[model samples]
Target chain A: METKMVISNLLHRPTRTIISILAVAIEVGLVMLTVGMTTGMLSETARRVEGIGADIIVQPPGASFLMGFTPAPMPIKIGDLLEEKVEHVAHVLPVLILMNVGVGVNIVFGINREQFDAVTGGFVFHSGGWFTGPDDIIVDDLYAKAGHLKVGQKLTLFSHSFRITGIVEHGKGARLFIPLQTDEELNQTQDKASIFFVKCTDPGYTDDAISGIRQFLPTYPVRSMAEYTSLYSSNNLPALNTFIEALICIALTIGFLVIFLSMYTTITERTREIGILKSLGASKSYIMSLILREAATICVLGIAAGEVGTLGARRVLQSSFPTLAVRLTPHWMVYAAVLAMGGTVLGAVYPALRAASLDPVDALAYE
Target chain B: MEPIILTSDLKKIYRIGKVEVPALRGVDLVVPEGEFVAVAGPSGCGKSTLLHVLGGLTAPTSGKVLVDGNDFSAMNDADRTRFRRHKIGFVFQRFNLLPTLTARNNIAIAQHIQGNGFNPHRFQAIVEMLGIQGKLNHRPYALSGGEQQRVAIARAVICEPKILLADEPTGNLDSENSQIVLNMLRGLNRSFRQTILMITHNPDAAALADRVLRMRDGRMLLD
Candidate 1:
């Protein structure tokens, strides 16, 4: 009976089609925003863990200073500071990675792996083996993504000219590593070690090691792997999360209300008819199911619309944030869709029950 | 044959704030299978009330209503509705065709609601027989008063219910359309052996029935 009425009503009025579309679109947009932000955070986190050049980052005092490009270059002497003072700081490989990147002064890190692994087991040279010799600079893929460099592309910085040998991606922050000898020669800092990475007997020693290093080097800073990643993430995001969350909440609230009211009015309009149906032998469940059938129809349409709206919204919003660390993964898409559909069902509960529980006698006589 | 419909000492009293207006008072009735019986009375009589009680659309305060030998009072509301769906048809004063549906679909839904599959040939025949061949696809709002009445009749008769209760079926129609609707009803009564219980104020419309039931003050004065 409900099936017949649902199909009949859909075909008859069909204006409800427009309403369903609009409702679903709003719902989907909300979900997309939520899942999109969630996804962005997840992707950025993954990227941060997937460090770029140095398998391990060596910085002064804190991760922020390393990520910040404002470093207090280590004192006394570059090689002597680590070689003479610290224990378990076995190999003191000195390399200059932090500097102003392009003509616009973007932060950058250049590595020299032969000198790098002499102290810490950090980054692996993925494609072209570690900067085995001088002038071999493996630039981070951001330069390519930023349309700054390609293979064989020459980047002339403050003191050195580099021919990009390979493009590399870092799991952690946005820094590049070249050969240490070349970096040191360019910076002309024979007496300076901006920072040093030390290999300990255990990964658990990381906290103690950082604390221990900070004690002797009072003015400097130190941080662990996770902390380092979080610093980059917090620095890059904050606003994206806050904006999307607010927009999604508002859209969902307004959309659900619209759908709820639309359904309510439909029930109100058909109150008398429902009574007639009840009189015609429809059970409470049967009547309820009949009305809920409309809700179901609306949900199906709404979910589809919301998904499309989300996609459209994502595309439109992408241009506003250039370094949007989120990847639009399919898993995130499915999650958003489920949210859109589930929200519609949740929103439909009150109206469906209200229409269902109506007394057939009263309903029939209702004007 | 046992009476298909039997009501024993049925009563309906509507309470308005403090006063109780008795609509039906211990009314006993028996309508046999395929019998054409007219219940006649002036306005306010219990003819309409009687029809509603017999059809199980309204429950009497006391007594028994049996349709096809089953006790209506004994069954629950759901069971009573099931009985109404399978055994009865109604044609209202306003010719209550659902305004949204086409004439054909309106008739078709009654059958579908009763779980009967569509038989186009039977539908086509019924529409043609009712002289609504040209207006099958027209909605109630699009059709004239007369045409809408015929469509209502078409819906009622198409289900081929055992008893058809028509409450002033031609009250809203003109004389010409009245004749058309009445003739179509009478044709259904004779050809299909339908048992019709129709109430009307129009003498001309009532005159067409095998029996005319006039109602007044919620009770029938004559039969």
Candidate 2:
């Protein structure tokens, strides 16, 4: 019965209820969307790193683990240096990283043709064959589907049109691939590659190989494939924790202010009603409970709307940016809901206190 | 029988920007159990203040108000509030029914606040006495002025408190509706032997009570 009163009171003013609910929903949806995008990118980067079939990765020191496209180049001679200096070295492949400006935020991996094929397990090509020329590029199925490109179609990057020589399955490598020399010539970087991929002759000795390479190039960062993938998971994404903390603050503030203003004005409008309740033998605690219950009911309904809104938003984003993965896990939704509800309850405290403290005589006399 | 409510030297002062305005000035009063008493006065004679203090909605500046021989003046805010919920009920001039609630729930809430859930038998009796049984589901806006007042009276008596404090119960009613509402109150008082303290400016309204007291300028006048 008390719940019924709360619901009736909130529904009494449709416009006010809608505005407050929308405020909460929008804040929660934004938190979910932004956080989902960040985690999704982190997961995608980790997956791509593991797909290259390399046992170890050697990059410049201090390179961001999740920043797959960062131009942190090292000498291409590091490939040979590893093969000569490390005992377990089987093959070392150098990869140049280039940014694809024409087609969204994508990384282009430039590799030596022979070493790339040998180390990449040779692509399970869906159409066409390997890139036979310097100006040719190969794409995976995901990129082809996202960009509506196929074999024999030309893709324009850096104002240069290159024919798509092949389309392979995704999870094999980065979406776009080019010749190492072609990338170096186009980007004005001669004899430089972003990082080196090292394979050990004995699979069981990869850990030792990584340690040996680290010693040979102490200034460079070296990690086994498993370690590298784990490094790029959501927990290790640089600045991701800080970004979520800032978002939580923003979401909580929005929830608090909207609910506070709503409940404050609502209590003010119902001052006479509160007076009547008091005169009808209502205790101060009774009045407080009434106000708090109403506020909590609003919060619950708002959170429900926010949860549904987030699901709808995820679908729309996936359709709009097919290549952009959005990880809207159940855990994230629950966290957002709890945070929103907590903020709303806190917001209602002052208004509930004010209502409970009203002087019955003065409030009853209010016009 | 002992007086169910007693007040001696009851005074309430209002502060208006450093000015002390006395709303109740050393008023002494007594009402025995089962008595229906009316306090008649002009506006600003502090009748409402006296009613508020008697109901424990407001505290007196000095002296004592004992309801059921328990000192209300000595009780703290929380205790006074609890006392009011269990021991007193109120009806106002404006018929202060919650507009958002149905007439039935309005009455039921009185019992709900008394820390007891609704009693179906008691609720039915009050609604029948007030002739508001069929109108229980209607909101306040849908009820007539007389119906609204009767619902208010029913709400006040639903908890069966020791005293019912009414401030101008029929002030917002037409002459016909006023008589009907007064009749309901008289019927309830006679049937249940309920104690009532009513504040009113109408002579006819006062005439319905078992005893009448008149006040002017915050002091009881000889009637």
Candidate 3:
């Protein structure tokens, strides 16, 4: 009966109820979508990097873990030195990475075809083949689909035109790949490489190879491929995590204020009804429960709506931008739901107490 | 029968920004168990004020109010509320049913508040006696004034309270509905021997009570 009363009260004011619900939904959706987008991009990039089949990665001293942010400061001879000196090193591919800010943010990799093929077990080409000329490039399927590009299509990068020679399967190191000599020539950085992808003769020799590389270049960043995905967490990027925290605070504020105003207005509107309840021997706790239960019901409904809305938004985003990944994991959904529920319930406390404190006589006499 | 309600020199003063306005002025009253008593007075003559005091809806400024062997004046706010829930039931002139709930839920809410849950047999008997069994599912807006009042009465008695306090229960009804509601009150009094105290200005409504008490200028007048 109490549940029925609470539901009926909410239904009685349909417009207010819907507005309140949508406000909570927007808060939850904002938190879920923003967090999902950032984490999704990170994990997706990490997975692709891992898919390169490299046993280990060696970057210059002080180089960022993010491949796109690292500069090509290491000499290309480091790859030759590692292959010649490090035991169990099958192949070492020296790669240059360029951060292209044109059109959109993208990472372009420069690699020698033979060395890259040997290190990564070769690319699975969906169409066409490896680079035919210095001015030609190979794009992953996701990038090609996103750009609506086909084999033989011309792609301009770094103010230089390159023909697309192949559309390869995704889940490699980078979306766009160009010849190493061409990249070094365009950037005027001959013999400079950003990182080295080291392939071990046997999977068990990864630790031995990394130790061997670390012996010569002690200050450089040497990471095993097995731990690559774990490096892409929010904790690894404080700025992104802070940005997510700020958004969560904003979402909390939105939920709190909406619930507060909604419950306050409902209490005021139902002052007489509250009085009637009091007159019928309803305790203070009962009245509080009534108001709190109503708010909680709204939050639960809003959370469900937000989940559905976020999934729909994800679909729209992925379809419109194929390369963009939006990962809606159950963990973050539960987190957002708990935060929304806490904030909404806290918002309802004042109004519930005020309603419970109302004098039955005055409330009954209220017009 | 011993008096179920007893008040001695009861007084209530309302202070609006320093000016003290007296609503109930040292009024003494009594009604025995199972008696149907009517309190008659013109508007602002403290009829509703007396009912509110007796119902524990408001505390008195000074005096002793005893209902169902419980001292209302001595009890704290929470204790008074608990006593009211177990012993006192109230009906208002406006037919103060929750507009959002169906008539059946409105009545069941009282039982829920009483912490006894619902009793289908008692609920059925009460609704059938009030002729609101068919209208149970309808919200208050769909019910007639007389029907709404009937629902309110059923709600007040659903917990089988020791005393029923009504402040003009039939005030808003038409003559036909008023007669039906008054007859229902009479039937409740006779069939269940329920103790009822009603406040009204209607002479016909007062005439239906076993005894009528008049009030003027916040004081009970001698019959």
Candidate 4:
């Protein structure tokens, strides 16, 4: 009977019910999208590191794992020191990765082709071969395709035209690669490199290699491949948690306000109806449950709709913009559902209490 | 016969900020089991207030209301709500039917709240007696004023409460509808021996009851 009454009540006020549901759906969608983007960026970064085929990456102290200009570059001598001191070091490639300020989408890595290949095996080229001179560059196939560039085309980097000598087979590594000497000369850091990618003699000896490398460079951050994929690795991106936390707080506030206003007005409008129920001997708990059940039903429906909407948006976004991904893991979806539904339930509490505490005579007499 | 409904010197006062307005002043009343009693008064004569107090819908200023030998004043809000569900049913002038529900569901809700699932025989009997069997599926707006009142009566009696309270049951109906509703009330009282306390301004409505009490200035007037 209570369920039927709640359904009927909501049906009678179709406009209000629809508005409330849509409001909740939009808020839930926001949380999913925000959290999805955060986790997606983290996962994408981890995959790029794994694609390098290096057992460990050593960054300058306090340098972020995110691909960007390091706060301070480590000397090129670190690579020589690791190769000479660490017995487990199969190969060490000193590289400088800089964010392209002109086109924020690409992170340009300055690498020695021969040494990079020794540390991380060479890529499969879709078009041409590797850089033949200081004026030549290699790019990812997707980036080249997206930018309508082909081998032998003149590509602009730092206001200088360089020939696209090779197109790599669209791997997860940074899209832009240039000769290490050219980048060092251009960036005025000829003897300094951002970090070193260290390969282990054997895949199973990565742990031993990391400990051996750590002994040489005690101040640097050395992360193994397995640790890079874990959630704990997210700490390497400074302020990432704060940004996601702020977004979730905004989502919760929107959900709370929408449900609170909708349910509060509903209880007010149904004052006489509540009185009638009370007159019929409905207890306070009965009335409270009736209101809460109505709110929960609305929230669940809204969450399901929001989940579907997010998935549709994710597919469209991923196809249109390859760089952006919407990760809707089952764990995050459960969190989103719990958050949205729990906020709505909290919003309904005050109104339910008001409805429960109403005086039957006064309520019935309410015009 | 022992009185099933008893009130001793019932006095009720309403406080609005600083002013105290008396609605019932030292009025004593009693009705035995299986009795149909009507309370008649003009506006502001405390008939409705008396009904509200008897139904345990409101607390009295200084009074003792004993229904079925249980002191209503002694019971807390939760107990009173429970006691009302099992012991008293109410029929208002406006029908007070939930607009969202069909006529049948309005009655079913009463039984549901009373903690007793629908008894098909009792429900069918009430619907048949009230002549609302055909209109069960229609929402409140679809039913005529008289049919709505009949449904309200059916809902009140569906739980087979110890006492049924009806206040201006036909206030919104015409002469024909009012007569139909009055006839149904009398029939239910006679057939089931149900104790009924009704408040109205209509002498014709009062004539249907087994006894009539008139009130003026919150005090019962001598017949």
Candidate 5:
């Protein structure tokens, strides 16, 4: 019966209820969406590292800043130095990347098939097997599909007609990695590869190998997968995270203010009624529930609206930027609901108690 | 018969910075089970304060209150609320029914607060007795002043508390409605043998109560 009264009271004043709930919902949704987005990107970077099959990542000094990027040149040649001095390194393959390519730009990697398998297990063919000929090469799925090229189709890539022997998924870097011999011939330069990954025979030797790489190529920055992942997450989505946090703080503040005033007004209006309830042996907890329950109902319903709004926003953004998705996870939704409900309950504490503790004599006297 | 309520030298004081104002001063009182008594006073004459102290709505400045042989002064706020809920019922001036609820829902809410489901028969009987059967589904705002007061009365009594405390139950009604509400109260007193202590300024309403006690300046003139 007490719960019913609370619900009825909230429904009685629809305008006030909506505004308060909106405040709470927006705050909760912002927190959920921001944390989820940053966390997702971080996890994405980790998954990428794991896909490469190397427990340890070795990069030159400040190499993370140059990932998928081109620079003038490092003072040291990483691929050559690892081959010369790193003893525990089983086999090292140099991988080069050029990020944010224009349309139809072909990315090049210099690797030997034997050395490449030291990390990745090579492509699992969707149709054709691994590349077996010099004239044969793997074409990127994006370019292959766009130009209507298929296996055995000789496609023009970087002024070279290379037969599509197989297609490699972007899991290994999404770039084309021809043999070191072909790479040197095509690029027509003897320039050393920018970055080379060291594969250790024993997983325990990964740290030693990273330290050795640092000692051998001290002029280059060395970044492990851990540091790389953290750097990538901070760089890529820092703005989104900050915006989400700020928006949530503002929303919750607004929500609390709205709830505070609304509940105060509601308690004031029900002065006589509350006095009567007190007279009837209703406890303070019962009275508190009456007000807080109304707040809760508003919170749950507002969060429902926010969930739908966020879902729609995510779908639209996902379509625009295909690689990314706004995952409205169950965990995020739970977090949002908790924040909304908790904020509303806390906001309602003062007014509800004040109303419950009203002196019957005075309340009855209020006009 | 042993009295169901007793108060000895009950006093209530309100403190404002440097001043302490007495709302009730040195009063001894008693009401037996099944007796219908009225406390009559003008505004601020301490009638409401007297009722509140007895109901455990506020603590007395100096004295003790015993309701059904339990010392209300000794109970904590939560304990007092529980004691008040099951042991006492209250009716207020202005027909203080929850405005959003239908008449039937208003009556049911009291028992609901007790954590028990509605007693359909008891509700139906209260509705029939109060002559508000047609207004059961009407919100308090949709009902007449008289009808609202009757709903308020039904809400109070539906819990079946041992004592019913009414502070101006007919204050909002006209003579015709007031007489009708008083008649219903008389019927409740006879049928259930309810112990009713009413606070009112109207002598006619006070007359309906078996005994009338007048108050002036925070002191009970007659009991």
Candidate 6:
């Protein structure tokens, strides 16, 4: 009977109920989508970096694990030193990475074709061969498809134009690649490399190569490729975690305020009905439970709607921006639902208490 | 029979800002078990206030009220509410059925609040007696004034409370509906020996009771 009353109350005012549900849905969607996009992009980028086939990476001291943020401060001779001096090092590639914010934020890697091919197994080119000229650029299939690019198309980066010489399969170090010498000259940092990619003679020799690199460049950041993906988590970026937390707080506030106002209005409108219940020998807890139950029902419905809405949003986002990855992990979905439920329940407590404490005589006399 | 309802110098004062307005002025009353008693007065003569006090809806200012051998004045808010849940039922003039619920649910809610599981037999008997069996599926808005009143009575008595406190149960009904509701109350009183205390200004309504008590200006007049 109590459940029936709650459902009837919600159905009695369709517009208010719908608006409340939408508010909660929006809150859940906001939290899920924002967190999903961040985690998805991080893992996607990490996977691509791992696909470069480097057994170990050596960056300049104080350099971030995100290669895009690292400057070309390390001398290019580090690659030759690791190759000649370090044991178990089969190949070493000196790469200069620059962050490009043209249509979107991306990293462009500069590589010597022969050394890059040796270190990274080799690029599986879908079309065109290798960089034909110093101004030629090799793009991955994803980047080419996103920009509607074909071989021989002219692309501009860092205010310099380059012809597309090849479209390779994705999952290399970066989406765009250029000649190492040209990148060094263009950036006016000749003989300097942002990082060194070391390929060990055997996959099991990764830890040995990392130790060898650490002996030579003790202050430099040498990370084994096996653990590279784990380093791309949100915990590695405090700023990103803070950003997600702030967004979640905003979503919680939205859910809280909407539920509060909705329940407050409902209590006011149903003052007489509350009195009627009291007259029928309802206890304070009974009245409180009724109000809270109504709010919970709305929240449960809103959560279901939000889950569906977020999935639809993910599909739309991925379709619109194929390069964009949105991962809706089961744990994050559960977390978001719990957060929304907690906020909405907290929002309803005040109104429920107010309803419960109402004087039966005054409530009955309330016009 | 010993008095099922008893009041000793019952007094209730309404505090409005700095002014203390007395609604019940030290009036003593008693009604024995299974009696149909009527409290009649003009508007604002403390009839509803007296009923509210008797029903444990409000506390008396400075007096003793014992209903069904429970001291209402001494009980705290929660205790009073519990006592009301187990021992008292109420019907108001407005036919205060929850607009959102069906007639059936409105009646069932009382049983739910009484903390007892539904008794289908009692429910059937109550609905049949009130002639609301066919109208149970309808919401309050779909029912006539008389039908809504009947539903309200069924909701009040579904738990078989020791006392039924009615405040102008037929005030919103026409003469035909009022007569029907009054006759139902009389039938309930005679058939089940239900103790009823009704408040009204209608002489005809008062005449249906076994005894009529009049009040003026918060003080009960001679019977």
- The residue-by-residue lDDT of candidate 2 on A297-342, one tens digit each, is 7777888888898888878877776678778888988888888888
Q: Please, what are the lDDT tens digits per residue for candidate 3 over residues A236-342?
A: 99999999999999999999999999999999988999999999989899999999999999999999999899999999989888889888999999999999999
Per-residue CA lDDT of model 1 for A260-346, tens digit only, reads 777777788888766555544455666667666776777677777777676666666655443354355677567656655565666
Q: Answer with 2 or 5, whichever has the higher lDDT.
A: 2
| lDDT of each residue in A1-367, candidate 6, tens digit only | 8888898899999999999999999999999999999999998998998999988888898888887788547989889999999999999999998888988798889999899989988999999979878999999988888889999999999889999999999999899999988888877888889988889999898888888889999998898886766899999999999999999999999999999999999999998889988887888989999999999988989998999999999998877776788989999999999999999899999999999999999999889
Tens-place lDDT digits, model 2, residues B25-144:
988898998999999988999999999888888888998889998898798777888888898989888999999999989899889888788799999999988899899999999999
| Every candidate's lDDT | 0.65, 0.86, 0.92, 0.87, 0.73, 0.92
Candidate 3 docking class:
high
- Kindly state the fnat score of candidate 4: 0.81
Ten consecutive residues with minimal summed lDDT in candidate 2 chain A?
A63-72
Model 1: chain A TM-score against the true structure: 0.60
Tens digit per residue, CA lDDT, model 4, B1-223: 7798988888999999999999999788889998999999899999999888888788878888899888987888888889888889999999999999999899999999999798999999999888888999999999999999999999999999999999999899999999999998888889999999999988899998999988999987842
Off by over 4 Å in 5: A44-58, A65-193, A197-265, A323-329, B72-76, B115-117
Can you give the lDDT of residue B17 in candidate 2? Answer: 100
CA-based DockQ, model 1: 0.28
Give the alpha carbon lDDT tens digit for every residue of A74-192 in model 5: 32255656767886777666664433244533455656677678677776565555667766676555445555667887865566777778765655644455566666566454554
The superposed Cα distance between candidate 3 and the true structure at residue B6, in angstroms, equals 1.0
lDDT of 6 at A328: 93
Residue A23 CA displacement from its true place in model 2, Å: 1.2
DockQ scores for all predicted structures? 0.28, 0.81, 0.90, 0.85, 0.54, 0.90
DockQ, candidate no. 5: 0.54
